[model samples]
Target chain A: MDLERPLPTPITPECRPYWEGAREGKLMITKCRACGKPFMYPRVSCPFCASRDIGWVQASGRGRLFSFEIAHQILNKAFKVKTPVVLAMVELEEGPRLLSNLVGIAPDPKQIRCDMPVEVCFEKLTDEISLPMFRPVGGAR
Target chain B: MSDLARMRELSNAVGIVGVDESDEIGTLPGKSQLTLHVEAITNAARDAGIKVSEIDGVFTAGQHSPATIGEAIGVVPRYVDGTTVGGCSFIIMVGHAMVALYHGLCDVAVVCHGESGRSGVGVSPRRDTALPGQFEFPYGFGGAPTYFGLITTRHMHEYGTTLEQWAQVAVSTRKWAALNPKARNREPLTVKDVLDSRPVVWPFNILNICLVTDAGGAVILTRADRAKDCAKKPVYVRGAGEGSEHVMLTQMRNLTFSEATQRSGAKAFAMAGVKSTDFDHIMLYDAFTSGPPLMLEALGLAKRGEGVHFFAEGRSTPGGKLPINTNGGGLSYTHSGMYGIFPIIEATRQLRGECGARQVPNARMSLVNGMGGMLSAAGTLVLSNEGSR
Candidate 1:
């Protein structure tokens, strides 16, 4: 286990609400008021409509595995995890995709399939930050 | 005039007079990053039979600024472009230079690249507070292989692309590498060898990734009228285009195909008034095994979900119907982090009939596509040996 694992420092002021929501076990994403479209990685403006009239909203935390890769090698020394880390892109039910990890399942290709149903689960990395990860909806179909 | 006609006239106005690499590529601990840049610029200037002071425009990318490179070379260029998108910045610079030259922003433009990828000489520290760091890095998603490998995985899931097909790219590219003495990994490679190689990420063996080496390359461009007085035959710029979709991998419109390549390639083809079938040779940047296939499909050279077959069936090999990556490519050649410049260099040489052993016979026209920042940006150039009108 890498005890020196690096945790995210929320440098962007717009993303502070996201970290705050994660701390509360609530998956948060931004939705544009003008276009009514949701987007990932909260920002001041909407990507779809270029509207600054955007606000944070609680997500369903339900998504499907869009794609994934089982990493046997880690590039960053600060990334502390067991071998064969499952790095994945999850398409949330709210329509925004996220870069996350798949937890509560073995990092094996035979066990994971694209479009598998998943639900977000948070891990408390620090007192202030809880990483929102995903896992098989019902123990790996 | 129509937009396409205007583009054609602008593209034809400029041509590459000289292209060359540094004194030596591959591990050069004795040289700094700036040294590599200066050496490549000097060599290219000499190759064009022009003094370094004669260059009126400068373009470059990487940790160093164009101003810093210009000062080191004692050049006060009138027009300067420091477009640092990623590996493909130099390719886009070619397009930027064409516009600058057509408008008389500068007469002689030189685009330069030099990276100490292997030696760590004067390499800048990566910023961990950027958008990717804030969103993706927290999930242990760092490095190019992890990010790019996902695209291959998604491609496989959607199109039923096989792991063996990806290995075929490595094997076929290595075959070309064996023919070039300058290629770093010239030893024979087989499909089985690629599969047996250690897995860095699922669907990606170590052999599927690009090699890390220290290298630099430069290209000198001037108006078509001035190109005739240069040392070598000018390779005319028939068409050039650049586009970008997103910076973060998660924000990509589609994981299976590169929209960036599609947009840039469409503009290039329109400007050149040429179809995909018009080119005698092609050079698609191969930063990873998946790059060639993905970009091929995006560029319309092959049908959707059928690009991998180009390599799997040996059609892109030395004697294939269409020759691709004749200089071995980033996979087997030296990939110094930013590999865009090397493709431009090789395409120019192939059009000049200067490639000794791997030369494609009677090669007249070629297409070069470069991707920057994990498919975030793309630059395409249609080049020909035939002089501009």
Candidate 2:
């Protein structure tokens, strides 16, 4: 009864390590080895100095929800039933901002506010990947 | 790089020999997007008394791909540029093309644009790219309503600009739309109507957004000496300016005001030797209703926090003075998604006294602005009835 699992969204050579690390339930961010400024969304070059001396480090997976919107409706036809999704951009405690889906909260527009505290939880959608979704520290179930 | 010299050189070099448009577009049915573009192009060339084969350069920007338009227009340009910003892009691209023509890149350049933005041409239900910001769109970010919502929230938080003040801009542009026969939202819109409109995003209602429309516009530019031989009045390209910063609103720093748009305008005004007060009427590209008033503050037409003040007083509306966006803008006018190109078309027509009912009584000089992305890329242009040789 052995069946091969589905292939993950083929990660490129430049971004393989980030994926491999994510499977370990660790979210990683890149920074220039020369300068310590934080970077998001794994890039080939350092945005700060345009330097290629980039390295990845594990994030605390903790952040503040800088800005957010609770969507009561889904825009795309495919995601039509997935209404009430809270899409948020979180400014990590490390000073790099990244966009993520805010889980564990009532997806109501009236309740969300800026500067709310949140922590990351990895959802293992596949054996090769774990998505970094966040939830309010004391959010609606 | 600034296009001030290019604007003057264009005025002294090639001139706009043609002025024309679509048949007052609303929701045109039974017409393909490409068909609409070709119709506008042929109409403009015919109005200019020129043939399609004679056009050496053809440009399409914003949403329309250069390859798609070049194939549709039946003319392969020696030079092609498809810089997607907002509607103001065509105006800036015209400035760049003038510089290229000065270098003998191409001769008769025609700027054309068409899109079924309202119809949503096969865009994915999810975000398009794996760009750094894909997660935001699923939650309904980056739509016209959302982008302006972000700006409006920040503006209110920082400067205490009120929602009524934001509504006033929609109110003022609609007043101008009422006079224009071509304007889609001809019925006058009150500030209350704008405020009462359903909120797509917080602080932004439906009236605050540009309508998704199927429309097209075209303009012809050629040698100044040759322009005099054509059938219509040639509005001189006085000064042109352009600049860019970043694309996504979440990524850009200091979203307080559009520095890039203001800077582009400053360069244009300085090169043209005209202040904001010098222009008789302005033909700024208005994608969302918030764009015009924000531009008023950004371009120094009104002071900071004074953008709302400029509109709330009723002085900025119509008869009080400092008339703007006489085309009803994208909000009330045709919003083909590439809105910048149409302002140039309208400015040329207005300067030529072609605007029948919407004509500004004695419009002499016009300042035009094109805004692309999340106010990331911008272009400002100056056009004058004082045609030069």
Candidate 3:
């Protein structure tokens, strides 16, 4: 993917690992040893227990579509060409949900429903950044 | 003791003495954010029959600081607060102002909000480096419509809420807008009209979203004793609560429900010793059509997934069992970025019986709720004209 129109994520110390992992086609989540729980949106401490014993674990890259929107307007100018995109919230089997885009599926209400099975597919946007977007498993392309 | 029992001292302790808005709303081409603040605050002081020098406390949020507002308004306030939570920041300021007055920090407190949301004169800086911009914005989650649309989609999935049900909220609010002479879009809207409007995002069309217009309003609070001498009938602050559990949308406890509202409204209702039925008028922030229903459900005004029916059944519209958003709401009324103060202004009008055409008949109690940061923070106020003395 050579599109550079949309804004890029500014890698920070806390979230660098998650972005780096996406480049390597890996989905990452923060797991806390103290609470034995997993969560998304990397943070220094466990959101559940406030424990500093946090570690990065490879997510299953498999989840169900929790909910989504078929945005008719292209919010970011970079993605101006991709009008009517499907923005989705995928709830990983690990009990945490993350916001991402949905590919390999039509952006239609009649076609999409909640709890649809999906799998992560990394798409490199820049040399240092790759977004973890999801697609319907064993569904349309 | 119950929260209500413990709240007796605070209940009716601080009364809202005055409410005012900037002279120009919708499109004030030359007016900047700072000017709007000073204009609204000055008008509020005049409404209360007080002078700018007498306003010892100054409160404001969004794109401006209290120090700047105080300097501009010619007040060297003893108490100042700049709580910028989001669109609901001014509402949260009310709760803070009440606390400050209760603690004897200030006698005359003025909470103001102004935004060049439409003119883009002095908007707040974008936090692209922040959590949402870094994580969600990259995925095309740009503004309120996209995220709120996601919320509405989830709500529909969980409760089997139909698109028409969501459109009904717009229809009912438009009816109220037609009554409000100052409402931006007073034209009658139907369910089909909402459903057929330009699509901004899934589960939402242009009509389902709030219009971005330049506007601002202010509320003045003082000790109940002093309120008796004010120019307007004192609308006592019967109960107030503010809650913030998360700053990001993904971190909410539940996507289908608003925890902030649940927490804030519970405290407000308990402190007021009243239930949903006690309110003669209600004002839930309608930044999006989905907001009112979600707030209603969270505040226990409606059962889970039954909020949309409150409108579909005509219970929340004009001449219904419950009246809400009589000022046309942010949807049809003026929405200058932070809309928390607009509802406060309308609620005050209801309690004072000053709303000419849109008044809730014999209204003595009004509930006003404001939400900020993608439903991240919530502030609830129960105002009453009945038991101030």
Candidate 4:
């Protein structure tokens, strides 16, 4: 494991809700009240039409592994043991694409395929920090 | 779109005279990026028969950079650029440098990039990790190789593009690299080799990934008139364009191909007044295996799914119809992680009639497509011999 770990931020004014919800093991996606389009990388405004009328809503966190890559790279010293890791882009049940990690799949290449269904799980890192991750759902909900 | 005159007008203003790269590039053990870039710039200047002091502008690429290339090279350039798009940065540098030169911002502009990526410079676990990086590692989107693999798979699903076509890209470039010793994957590779290679990411075998060598390439651009006396023969920048939309694949409207490549290539083709089929040579960027196929589709070389067909028929290999990646490209040649510059280097050599065995005979016009980010940033340049226009 890496000694010099890189931790995420606290639930501050801008990103409080996201961190807090992750701590509660729930997924939240923001939407623009003006446009009703969902978005990831939570921000104060809608990136589509540039409307600031945004609101937070609970997301089912159910999605599919639309596309993914197997990373053999050890990004940090803490991650050396976990070289050849799998990272992915999950298209959420809501709409926006989320940059989240995948879990619960064999590291072997044949274990995954495009458009595979996955569900989100929160992994707590430091105090006040949790990440929304994904894993293949063996069967339906 | 009668930019044919405009392309000529741009060529009349600026031309890229010489291109050079550091021989001992990539993971120089303890060498810093600055030293690599300096050596590359000096080599380029020397190859162009000019002094380092003549350069007045420098452009650097990538966001997580230590400093501007000019400052590190000890030159106080009149123009300093820190255009931070990942791999395709050097390509945009050409377009931006030309614009800067057009208005008389600088003379002797040098576009430079070097990273110890293969040597692994203080590279982080991707800031998005846990947020995305660490969080996704176990589920398979491990690195760029597989990240691109995901995109390639989608392309395959939607367009009927096949794995064999993607393999053709790797095989073709390796054939070129087999001849050029600097290429990392010069060993013979076939479609079967591509199919059987260990899977780094689904749809991408080890051979499909670009070589992560650490090297720096530099190109010197000067006013058209000054280029006459600079070196052997100058390759005019006939047309150039750049496009940017999203930084990550998640944010793009679609993941199959790059809007940047589409937009940039459109503008370049329009400006050059030549269709994609007109180019005698192509130096497409291949950061990952999927970059070219998607880019080829977006750049209008092959229709969406037709890119696979183009490759399947042997249209892009050397001595083939399209004759691409003649300098072995990133797939076969030095990837340095930032493989954008090598395409330009090869294009310049082809224009100057210097690529000995690999030269495309009578090659007059060429096109180079550059990509940055996960196809977030793109630039296309049309180069031709001085009198072609």
Measured by TM-score, the strongest candidate is: 1
Worst 10 residues of 4 chain A by lDDT: A2-11
Give lDDT: candidate 3, residue B205.
93
Give the Cα error of residue B310 in candidate 2, in Å: 2.8
Clashes of each: 0, 9, 2, 25
Q: After superposition, how far is residue B10 of candidate 3 from its true place, in Å?
A: 0.7
Please give the range of 10 consecutive residues that has the lowest summed lDDT in model 4 chain B.
Answer: B131-140
Model 4 over residues B88-164: C-alpha lDDT tens digits?
78888888888888879998899887777677654443453333332333233335664566677677767777778
Sorted on TM-score, best first, the list reads 1, 3, 4, 2
DockQ, candidate no. 2: 0.21
Better of 3 and 4 by DockQ: 3
> Between which residue pairs do clashes occur in model 2?
B13-B224, B14-B222, B14-B223, B85-B372, B86-B372, B87-B339, B87-B340, B88-B340, B88-B370
Which candidate should be chosen as best, given DockQ against the real structure? 1
lDDT of 4 by residue, A42-119 (tens): 777789889988888889989888766666654344444365556677888888777666677775556767688899
Q: Candidate 2's residue-wise lDDT over B226-345, tens digit each?
A: 777887777777777887766666565556588888889887787677788788778766766667767778889878767666665446566656667778888887787777777888
Candidate 1 lDDT, A1-141, residue by residue in tens: 334346776448888888889999999899999999999878888888899999888999999999999999888888878778899999999999999899888888888989999999998887888888999998654
True contacts kept of each: 0.71, 0.10, 0.65, 0.36
* TM-score, predicted candidate 3 vs. hidden true structure: 0.97
**How far off is residue B79 in model 3, in Å?**
0.7
Model 2 agreement with the true structure over A1-141: per-residue lDDT tens digits: 221212233455666776677789887888888788878767799878888899999988889876654444434442332555566767789978766677887765446655678988876756666667788876565
**Cα shift from native, residue A103, model 2 (Å):** 5.9
CA shift of B276, model 1, Å: 0.8
